[model samples]
Target chain A: MSTIPEDLSYTKEHEWVAGLDDGRTVTVGVTAYAAEQLGDVVYVQVPEVGAAVTAGDAVGEVESTKSVSDIFAPVTGEVVEVNAAVVDDPSLVNSDPYGEGWLFRVQIGEEPEDLLTSAEYTSLTTAES
Target chain B: MSRSTPLREVHEALGATLTDFAGWLMPLRYGSESVEHNAVRTAAGLFDLSHMGEIFVTGPQAGEALDYALVGWLSALDTGRARYTMIVDGNGHVLDDLIVYRLAPEEFLVVANAGNYPMVARELTERAGSYDARVEDRSESFALVAVQGPKSAEILAKLTEADLDGLKYYAGLPATVAGFEALIARTGYTGEDGFELFVRNEDAVPLWNALSEAGAGLGLLPAGLSARDTLRLEAGMPLYGNELTEEQTPFDAGLGRVVRLDKPGDFVGRAALAERAAQPDQEDGPGADALRLVGLVARGRRVPRHGYPVTRDGVVVGEVTSGAPSQSLGKPIAMAYVSRSAVEAGGLTVDIRGSHEPVDVVDLPFYRRSK
Candidate 1:
């Protein structure tokens, strides 16, 4: 029963990409399904602003009470922005995973081709749960 | 497929997140584990400990049999009292940490960790071959429910007519709870004042419902194993797999007091334990160079997890056994086994995923409930 927004694109690693329609600067955050599975989030590490990254690169880490996970770059680009609010308070990732819990933003380097649609992401999460 | 407890359906109905633990499917959390942990620390929290193993040893020689099988002098334990003890191999390595409750003059209940009970039962049976004791693994027929916190006594008092004021810590008595038969033991793993109700499997749901209703206004939540881990960690309790292992002894974990070498008869690991007790500080002894267990509080926000290495100036000194973001301390805390030399030299850090996070080595038990 995770919220999968129709406007967003997802990766197999559970990161959701917003603004794919714009194809320039896109926002990224972990899906609600990933956050719920991690239990209570305690710490978050996001890539530094202006760092260059590629798709599937482990740029940051999300640590919950019981375990930790890697945050991968959904698309290749330079890190445009990082969420200081979520870094300061990691619980935001659990409280508002789709909104205020956005991890970072990246400028698109190439056309993203492997992203999953909302329907596809729903099936992926369903299979996982 | 993993085994399911009798409360599995009830947990599923509550929308709990189920996880496999020691081959059993049990609830990890219902809503938030932190909230459950805090509730247990402040008010109360209910736990389904049915996954734990319950073995009964009964007969005229039951006490003597346990006295030889376990590390403690159980034969000297009075009826209605419980002892925190362990079953060790001949080499003095820990098999499992157990809580033995003497229910009658000739009946004793041995509660063990879920993963080690079968072996414990088999070992106890083999050890009691010459004695007149009968060992029965009654784990499948029993369900354990624990109400833990400062207000546990008050909540339990409403459901049973038993004398709550008279029950001392680490004591148990048979009582009728909510019109069901149960062995009410004043024992808990959360390091709080609590009662563990051992009832038949069929009585679990209704008993849970009754306790929930009685504790409605007193702030009791259905807690899971995740919360239970943090609570016990803060209390400095050693987990069986994390702290006690087959390669280590109780003395190595800094819990040698539970071993009674002065007891009259010969017991398992008597010779080895006596030798260890005699020359505890000898450099050439068995565990002289081995890592000793200690508590660590992270100087940074990142939590240290199991199997992480403890380092001193980039040199690996020990390994973290258990760790978590403590709700009470508001900082990450961990229990680890560090070499004696590293402990004396000070300046300890946990290598958290390749980052040497500075840590302060405090005394065991990062948090203690104010009495």
Candidate 2:
């Protein structure tokens, strides 16, 4: 019931990091499990482009119907671009969390080698349920 | 910390996501919140409300006791009726908002919020000493099941001998429903005509099954706290934690009319309420900046959350108390307490992120029954 692509790196916070086709940037988004549990994300405050961010820093906040959660960054990078479409339409995260609803792309100077693998992320989120 | 409702196993069986709210392992939802919200709005939905605290007050002076315990007149209630009242503290601040049902001439059942059960019971019992009333906590021995929505009455009418329609809103009738001896109350949190059934703990499962079976034809689904929240929000109803709390008085929460100050005699917070009412509507009441509850509807899909600042002309004015993208309204809306000056200034704005967005100061019940 989960889709965790092996091509990406993961975080304990359930964010997925995929190296973009440009190679210099990595696309970041929350995993399907995290989005599902968040329950109808009503608001997303994503960081703007060119904002400097460190690994494990809260990049933004996502609010659901019942509670609010901080979206964490898995790699040390500068925000290259934000997905305004997803910010306008939060249900996209619920529907296509990994693909079109990708949170943002960061031009990371250093991608964390300690990032979890897809298998590890799946195991973690499954245990969380 | 220990007890689980009869629906616990059923919830887990149906793969519901469970949460420990008020020491009860209640299901927040079985699946999607959107689907759950739609289910209750479209057809019928069942709620396991056994976690609600039920206290019985009996004896000749029970009516007098409750009148003093609550900010409501209990002496005037008919046997088969219920009233929504607030249990206030010494400051007239709400301890808990509850529904008191007069079951008999001298007996009443006070239903309280799950989180404030012990405090409410203790506060009430202490005040009940002067009167001839004896208090009993029936939370563990009894179970509550609420079937709500337009289809609820149709499904239940087939099983209950009582005249459900005759029992108007906020009224109760002693009757047998689905062969279970229960008190059928035409009262609910959702803005709909429905019944809340109170039964023995042992009979909960069967009653649930019978209701489920009968509801099958009416598109009924077992709803959880998720649906409950959205449904109540659509109805513009306030939650205990969000709208009403220890710091909030019923009068400030837009429930001032529920207090009958002129009625015979003293309540727990009578002097305080009288003082509050008599004080010239202070922009900021004594010892604090002026604050009053108000609603906000964001223009777009963006939801303004709790603690987010409400601004006007680039000045921070208020903070969001509770907010959600309403399933029924199809837009993001919020409730917050703004300064009386800000509210009177006509137009207002809420600071969503860095941008200040305008908010409409309208009447409550943001969503109305269109059907």
Candidate 3:
């Protein structure tokens, strides 16, 4: 039912991490599956740029017409930038979750390791009932 | 533990995203909230209302018992007729708002909200302790399905043997639908030509399938809670948590007419309502430029959200109660309580987010189709 893009890795929290490299920045956003579940995106509490975040720490929040959900950090890094375009147009998250819907870009802190690959994430999501 | 309705499997098969509503796992939406909402307005929609509670009361003095318990005098209602009434406690606070259906001279069925089922049942039982009537909760054994929209009757007419044409507004009758016995009530909350069918849960599967098959030509899609809210909002109906609450008096909720102070016998909240209505000053009184319930036709594309500030003459008059981009109306429409005295000129400006936008105040029932 939910489509997982092949180029990005995933977290158990349903967030997607794109690209790699120890020092290069990687983009992070919610999966299509998560966006479809939350009906009508209304507001997104944008995270502070240049703030450090660790894995499992909350990055920001996304408020839908019905509820508000917290976005978590998939890996430890510094948030370099946030998508202001999506903040102005919340529906973009529902439309292009991977491209224009990228929530934020984080400067990779150290060696990127133990991240679930596209195949692994696919199987991980598939194994879920 | 929470419970799932009979249409749970059916919703999952249709790829509906489920949500927990009042301890019931119900479908929040299918493809899109707006699409499902528009489908109910333009065509037809089938909703599973099985989570609501249906309680039957029958005895020699059932009418008297109901009149004592309910805010409405049930004895006055004729057979096959239904009336919306309120249930209040001794302090006049609203316990629940429900519809009482009279089936016979001494038999009445009270349909209550799902979350307030136990509370209503328990309260009724406590009061019925001194009465000759009996209360039995038939919620679990029965399932209610709502078929609402302009094309509802046409599709339903083809499936049932009962003469639906003879059934008028607020009237109900016994009928066989989809080869199962059901109480067919020609009433709905969607403000459309609709029917509420009460059938045994065991027979719900067949009935749902039959209705779906019969409704295919009518373009009836299984609607979820999202559509239900938009439809009810357009109809000027109030949700319990939003417009109606325990702290709010009935008159404040725009339901003052339902309370009958002149009627004989002392029902709960009647005296307090009378005293409050007779008070020299009422908060709900037509104060000069005081905020009242009015429809706001947005000047721009920005859809107003609840709690948004309503500004008139650079002063905050009220806040938005409900708002959305209406699919049928083709614009950003909203309802807010604006100061009646201050907003006498009609057009009021709403401070949407950070932008100041002019809004016009109009009477409710925003979208009504000429029959």
Candidate 4:
């Protein structure tokens, strides 16, 4: 079973939002369930820092050996930082999806309300699997 | 619902990620596909190829029927030997690529792609109307398993009494494997030394278990279609739907040599293929003025996928048929059909999404194993 940390919020697109409790900046990465489905990640294209993104916008892409998927923005925000480590070695997304595989951080523009709690995210992943 | 192979339960037990392929449920991968691909290159990889279609042609005139049905001169093929050939429509467009194995004096087994076998069987039956031959589709009752890599021979030696040293490439012989009656064919698509075992569907699970047990010490792992695709791509083999289609002739894919124009009798697409063969020679080969298949290695990390346009100077000159991150080459490679003039002009790039990624044109087959 894929791990769903109780402290983070998630979107239906399978991205997890961390540090949302602080109400200012939040780190985002694809969930463990999404990583498992994607097999091996070979390339990662993250949004540039300082770019404004609306919720549900496809801001980046995650490419694997078999297929490619869009990285949707979980909330409306301006990109604060992008992970350069994952860009250099994409396998980190498969090996450590939650900790070091974070894609980017965003400075929130408005409070997000549609993100799912950990329990809801668990149910969604369970249904998919 | 998709059809399940005989080893469906085995794949499920191994925690493989299953995907629908050509109306059959097949394992895409058990773990990391790259690891599986590497295993096949360095050691050995087992593959459940039961999804491929097996059509048997038998009787005194089987050779004549196949010669008329396919491009190659099957009648000239000796028993126990196999030849790669293709079936084309009346217009000379490739219907499907096939491997014809002569099992006996009057019997031949034609292995075809899963998606095109039904049509191939129907076409063969129709074409053999005047000949004393019988075509049978035995795909539902037969199971195919392959062991591929440098260590394949060592692993298979433990199971069968067949003369491993005597068996040549593209040869098949009946043998008892793990106490099961099987036709061991020294053939594979992974560009490695290997053997493909054809057995009854009921014997699949036990045979797989026995091979797995025997090969456990030789670093053998169960590979999936995902790995198989990359392996064949690195070997520069043309896939059915990707590199070949009903709209393209074998000449278009640089495989015109498979068409035997000098055969005594007239075969299907004979006149059209002869016309193509009569065309004036070009720098590369026949049909150089038309779109020619070429290999592309990407300079950037972003992979170029199927259906992506091959561009030069912002103009679409060709299209990518197959592309993947090659484990053997340590780079992203692809097969695309570029126009002859564009190939001569140089400066090729694949339009990956919106960005034009520069690519180098190289010879087909990005990887070859050392003997």
Rank by lDDT (best first): 4, 1, 2, 3
lDDT of 2 at B64: 93
Query: Across residues A17-108, which tens digit of lDDT does each residue of candidate 3 receive?
Result: 98764448888998887787777775666678999888778878776655567898888889899999998887888888888988898887
What is the lDDT for B51 in model 4?
Answer: 92
The TM-score of predicted model 4 comes to 0.98
Candidate 4 C-alpha error for residue A83, in Å: 1.2
lDDT of 4 by residue, B1-371 (tens): 99999999999999999999999999999999999999999999999999999999999999999999999999999999999999999888999999999999999999999989999999999999899999999999999999999999999999989898899999999999999999999999999999999999999999999989988988999999999999999999999999999878788888989999888898999998887777765223454457889999999998988999999999999999999999988889999989888888899999999999999999988888899
Worst 10 residues of 2 chain A by lDDT: A14-23
| Candidates, DockQ | 0.91, 0.64, 0.21, 0.94
DockQ of 1: 0.91
TM-score of chain A of each: 0.97, 0.92, 0.88, 0.98
Cα error, residue B22 of model 3, in Å, equals 1.0
Per-residue alpha-carbon lDDT of candidate 1 for residues A11-117, written as tens digits (9 for 90 to 100) = 99999999978659999999999999999999999999999999988999999989999999999989999999999999999999999999999998877879999
lDDT of 1 by residue, B1-371 (tens): 88988888989998899999999999999989999999999999999999999999999999999999999999999999999999999888899999999999999999999999999999999998899999999999999999999989999999999988999999999999999999999999898889999999999999999999989899999999999999999999999999889988888888899999888898999888887878756322345357788999999999999999999999999999999999999999999999988887889999999899999999977887898
Question: Which consecutive 10 residues in model 2 chain B have the weakest lDDT in total?
Answer: B280-289
lDDT of each: 0.93, 0.83, 0.80, 0.93
Write down the lDDT that model 4 would get: 0.93
CAPRI verdict (incorrect, acceptable, medium, high) for model 4: high
